[model samples]
Structures are given as structure tokens and as C-alpha cells.
Target: MSTATNANELKITRVYDAPVRAVWEAWTDPAQVAQWWGPRGFTITTHSKDLRPGGHWSYTMHGPDGTDYENKTLYYEVEECARLVYDHGGNDDRPPLFRVTVLFSESDGKTTMDMTMTLPSPEAAAETAKFIKKAGGNGTWDRLAEYIDKTQSGRESFFITRSFRAPIDVLFAMWTEPGHFSQWLAPAGFTMEFHDADIRPGGSTFYSMTNGQLTMYGRAEYQEIEKPSRIVYTQQFCDEQGNVSRHPLAPVWPETMRTEVLFTSEGPNETRVTVRWEPCGEVKPEEIEVFKQARGGMTQGWTGSFDKLEAKIAGSQE
Candidate 1:
């Protein structure tokens, strides 16, 4: 944990769209770093990368202006998914231009990264800042985000099944009828405010779900409807008027998702519900990845809501 004496060092912080481990791998993995290590309009070709304490990494950054900057890095410390300390500069005999330290942290399943560049003298810091700002250090981080998403997206679907004490008819009504839906469709701590709801084939529903002071709008267009059996729909974020909107917290989230809920009669007094969720048409690869990354949170939300549904059904039966 060495500190820089110069007062003019450069420090930048960003919260990445991916988890901390993904961010750490992007820095240490040569293949991943080659995809997004340099500024915008620049490409990196790695000659060799030894990612360990006392190891060296050599690469050439090819700028769009046809200038090739030969770079080399000497790793000083490597703490897995936590910290990386290295000396990065041109391949020369003089003192390294700067000592770079990167710290990775995660909160609420997202990654926050901090990068500090320390130069030996204020004069050197001033000179380096111009090149860094012009070369687009910020763009480098932005590219890293795209790389992470591109690498993470896959053909993964979210699936969840729950058993309830109510009959199949009751469970089916809860999903297809707005009256029953308005009673137990939302998760704990959230209430639904319907702007419009028509739960039949080719019909749509729009609503705003509010939790305390926060409210989020959602819309669903029914694709398939089989009474007492299943319901298929395309769901998206929407405004009060039902216009499509981006997710409040995630910008790259898929604009539309295909949701299928199947109801089965387990017995005379029992029902089974299975939900299959996947991204829908024309979605960006990165956006699909974002959906996949959020599977955990989605599962939690569904679990909470299903628990409420189970309780509501029990009360009615009693």
C-alpha cells in the first residue's frame, strides 16, 4: 500500500455493470484485456502477459491515427478480485511514467472499481493527464463494460416452480383475471396500480407497481391464453400511458421479455405453477446478458410474491 508523494496524481472511479470477479478477470486475463484495454479508437495486441506478482505484460497499443505506442507493465501485487498494483509505462530505461493501482469491490451484486495513477513528479503528472484525457481513459472503462456484457450474455432462461394449496382453477384465475390479479400479483411491500388490464389473447395490461415512495410501470401483451392451463406474454417496462420505457436502474436491460406461466392440477385441492422467462425479439446481446445477470434478483422477487399468493389462497380456502 504505497502512497504517492506528488499532489497531482490522477484518480478515477466507476461502478461497472458486471460483478467484481468479471471486472478482475478483464484486468488479469490477457484475452479479455486485449478486447478493451486501450482508449477508444485504439486496439491492443499483447505479446505476452504473465499475471502474477513480479511478472511482466508487454503489448502495443495501436492508435487510430496510425501511431503505435509500445507499452509494458510490471506487476507488483496481485490480490484476486480485490487489488492490482503495477508499474505501467513505455518500454524505456527511464523511470516508469506512473504506478497504477486498481481496487475492485462489490455491493448489491454490482462491481465498483477505483483506479489511481501516481507519477513521480508534478511535471510528469501534468503531462500524463493531457494524454490520458485525450486518449479517452473514460472510453476504456466504457469499452470494458461492453466487453463484460458481451462475454456474459448467453441462452440462459429463468425457471421457477411453486406449489400452492389451492385448486388449479383458483390458481389460473389469479393469473388471468384482473380482479384476482390485483389481489396477490405483486411482491411484498409493493402494491399494483393498474392503468389498464385486459388479460386475454392479443390483449394487454399496464400497471404501476409502487413501493413506498418509488413507483415503476410495467406492461404485458398476452401472446397465448389457455384457460386454467397456461398464459404466455411479452413484458416490458412502460410509462403510465403504457409507452415503452427503459428499466429504472439498468439501462442495457432487454426491452421485452417473454414470460410463460403454466398451471397444473396436482390433485383435487393442490396446484402447481411453473414460470419460464426469457428475453424476446431484437434484443442486444449485451442486454440479454444483463437479463441473465439479474436472474438472482428476479428469483428473489418471484419467491416473495409467490409466498404472498400462497398465503392469500390459504386464507380464502379457510
Candidate 2:
């Protein structure tokens, strides 16, 4: 999935590995929607859901910090399994913040969801985009993807997306070029150095990251590298000598994890990157549980890296 923003609208497009009917049911069915309706660490209570033109769906979003936000959506148009148009972010006290139009289509047994939130002005749209990022609102879609993946394929994974103000090719180079990758791919306050980097299909990279006190070594074995579009790799904690090992602090972490990164061009100068992570080879139940439980930390780590990446890109532009 990818997200983009125009002058007065926020656009998001995602492809789900499920049939159109299944995707529609997962979205329209209140029972399934409640499971992944809010951002990470948030839940929702659907008070009343009437999925029809002129009907209303009311709910309360419960934040992680015990904050409850009331929301109401009035449907203007609803075509079963095809499209939806609704006014969202309204309650008894206020009017809707924006109008949303979502279109769903299926091809090759997979469903594509395209959604646009139309705001009143470009400034309003920009502000909303900032608010969504600050609140991790985008995680809601990732959660939806996870829900569908689990239900349809019995697979569990972690997902995150970020839109960068850089061309798709530039962003792709930032990942594949070791010199650029090491500049911002480390956790906050840490530095990364690659011993040997072969970032191509069937190749691998060995790198170490440190923050003065402790250093961690890892290896990424590239499985697929489609220029300017996608990259698939298997990552594992390893010794300085390049031998696979378990994380020193997280002994129960999965021995190997598969990472898939998709880069989509939002515009000529903007790109959206979506990353999915899951246990790669045979893994035990405990490892999977640890992976699931570490989502919050994973989010934080990736966010920190992204912050640095953003700064680096800004510096380059200047």
C-alpha cells in the first residue's frame, strides 16, 4: 500500500491479498472492523452501524492512553464491494472534518483499495497529514492489512508506511547504496558501518551498528531487488564474523526475519515506502509471540530511522 497527498486531498492505495468479497466483508462487517479499526494500541467500539446510503455508523475510538474519541460517519453512497462515499470525523458537537471516497477493485484474485480524503483546503489537508503521522493514524491501514493477512493466509507480520519527499529512484538508491544506506539506517544516536555490502538479488550485506557502549552486528541476505520498486531480504542478527546468531538482548527473537519493502511513486518527487516484516524460516510459537509483542518497539525503532532518513534527504536537497 502507498499514501500520497495532493493540494486538498489525502490519498491512500493498498492492495490486499484477498478476494474482493472477503475484503469488503472484512471492512463492512462491524465485528471484523472492530478488531483493527484504530491505530496501533487503540481499539474501537461500534455503537451503531448502518451500511447504506444516508445511514450512519457511529463509534468511539479508545486510545491507548484511556482517551475516548467519539466519531460518526454518514454514508452518501455505498455500492456493495465496489465503492463508498462518506463524511467522516463528525460527532454531535462538530461537523465532519472531511469527506472520504473509497473505491475497491479486484484483479488476479487480489483486491485494491483506493481511498481519498477531501479536505476544505490545501492547508487543512497538510495539517491533517501531520496530525495523522504524529498520531500514527496510518497504522490503522497496516492493522487492516495484518488482519486480512492473518484471516486469509494464516500469516502474521508487521507493517509500516512512510512517504518521503524524494523521487522513487533516489529513495531506492538510499536503500541499495551502502554509502547512503549507512548514513541513516541506524537507530537514533547510533552509527552504522558496512563491512561488505552486496545489495543485489542473491547477494548480502554485513553491517554493524553502535552507540559507543554496545555494538550489534547483522546480515541481510537479499532475495529480490527490483530496481525502484521492491526489495525482499532475509535479515538475521549475526556475529562480527558473519555467522547467524540470536539477538543478545532479545534471546527469544526470531532467528531469521523476512523483510519486504515496496516503493511506490506518489508523484514525480515523492515516494511512499511500505515495509512488511515477518518470521522467515521455521520458527517456534514463542518466537512468533515475541515478534508480535515487539511491534511497539519495532515501530519506534523504524520511526527513529525514518526521522534520520528524512533529515538526510532534506540536507541533500539543500
Candidate 3:
């Protein structure tokens, strides 16, 4: 597979405000790719897709202007969550189109995708450029970003998964136990002060997080806890006395949220943790809007917290 792009090839690169795995999955998974693979107002129907080397992927893209384009791709190389080299063209005995190499990389919790399409010749590149410009290729990327953000369908759920170089039990204890949990739970620039922490099912926790000038209090009721497996909790904004209250910064936000975290062992000393957060209880329209608006910031907050948690785990191992 060619890793470098030539000057004559068509190259497009975009850095998505999302994780590497999420972005890679959207590009490789046929079901997910169909959601945003085509141009604006276009729908894709996949006939077959095989993601391995030498495999073939066939699909029909229907345009908003009542045109149908048949596409087929032969996978030359596939690297999980990293690179894909494929040759794509028209199906049904039609001539080949171009060879594309897409590379995925991550830095600071975000993903950058670089795609290069090399046509057969300069004439072919010129002809394809016209079609790409007329079809609005940038719109397809925007659609992809929207698809990744709305992954859980209509639900305003935030999901993130990360791998840790620590055992599942160690990670579980660090997450549930009071002192260790507080040490790395808060986002960057914030410090947590726990008033109470009861770690078992039916137990509750109340904490205040301060960032120099501002302080926010939160309470959580543990609904379910399975050691080294999963934890479900109900979280809400609260006052110093633990009285339920709207968020100090976003009064229109939901008062309560349901959070679920799953821990899975990848190896003897490796673990993968997945977190899902969703607003619960009676959510007003304005509250929903607030939640939607806060999604980006919330993701950034979690990413920062996880970065600290990773460092904490590494230090403890030493």
C-alpha cells in the first residue's frame, strides 16, 4: 500500500472532534458508512461489503436529483483503526475509477483522517475533479460528523471508550473507592471535595468541584454495582446541603442523568472501559437543547479526566 500522496492525486484531510476508534469504525463498517458515505441528500444501499484484504464492497448511491450511481471497491489492505487501501470504481463491467488510501491518526483525543485518491491519469483526475466539486464532497464529511455525534439514534447519550494499562479490578477499585476516585475523576483545572461517598448499590455520593473561582456540587445515587464489570448511577446537580438543584452554569440543563460504565479485560494487565451518559427523568425541551449544546464540552471534560486517570494508573503501578 502506498503511504505517500502524489501531487496529481486528489487529497482531502479532516480532523474530526471525535475519538480514533469511533472515526475508524464509521469509515470501515458498512452499516455505519451507509449513513453518510454519499453526497448531500443522497442515500446509500449496500449490496455487499467485506473489510478484509482482497474482499469486495458493492453499493448503490441514490442522489437527491433522482440519479443512481453504482460503486464497488476492492480492498487491497486493511489495518484495524489505522489504514485502508482500496480501489474503487463503477460496477457491472464498467471501467475502474481510482485507488484510494485513507489513514487514521489520533492526537489529544481527536481523530484526523487523510484520504488520497489517485486517478489512472491526469485526464481522469481532471474529469473526476469536476464531478467531486459538483457533488459537494465537503457536505459528505459534515454528514459524517453528524452521524458520529448522533450515534445512539435520537438519544442524547455521550459514549466514550478507552483502554488502560491496568487490570480490570484495579481500574474498578480506582473508580469506585472514594479517595482514588476523587483524585482523577474531576476534569482538568478542577478539584473535587467529597462530602460523602457510599460505594455500594443503593448508596449515594455528594461532592463539590471547584475551579478556583467557581464551585459546582453534584450528587449521585448508585443504582447497580457489579465488581470489575459495570456500574449504574443516577447523577444530579445539588447544593452544599445536597438539595437537588439546577446546574449553576446551565440552569436549563437536565437535573438528572443516568450514567453506566462497563469495564472489560483485554489482557492480564489491560482493560477497556466504556462510559455512557444519558439525561433521565422529565426532560424539558429547553433542557434537551442545553444537553445537546453541552455535548462537545462534556466530551472534552471526560477526555481530560481520563487522561489524568491514565497517568494515575501508571504512577500506582510504579
Find the candidate with the highest TM-score and give its number. 2
Span of 10 residues, lowest total lDDT, candidate 1 = 1-10
Write the residue-wise lDDT of candidate 2 on 1-318 in tens digits: 234456889888877889999999999999999978888899899999999999999999999999999999999999999999999999989999999999999999999899999999989988998898888888888888889989998988988888888999999999999999999999999999999999999999999999999899999999999998999999899998889999989999999999999998887888988899999789999999999889888888999999999999999999
- Once superposed on the true structure, which residue ranges of model 3 sit more than 4 Å away at CA? 1-154
Q: Please identify model 2 stretches exceeding 4 Å from their true place.
A: 1-6
Q: Which run of 10 residues does model 3 get worst, by summed lDDT? A: 1-10
- Candidate 1 has what TM-score? 0.52
The best-first sequence of candidates by lDDT reads 2, 3, 1
Better of 2 and 3 by TM-score: 2
- What digit string (tens of lDDT, one per residue) describes model 3 on residues 89-186? 75768866888888999999778788889987767777787687555554566557657767735566655556677889999998899999999899
> What's the CA RMSD for each of the models?
16.6, 1.6, 12.0
**lDDT (Cα, 0-100) at 237 in candidate 3:** 92
Quote the lDDT for 84 in model 3: 94
TM-score ranking, high to low: 2, 3, 1
Worst 10 residues of 2 by lDDT: 1-10
lDDT of each: 0.78, 0.91, 0.80
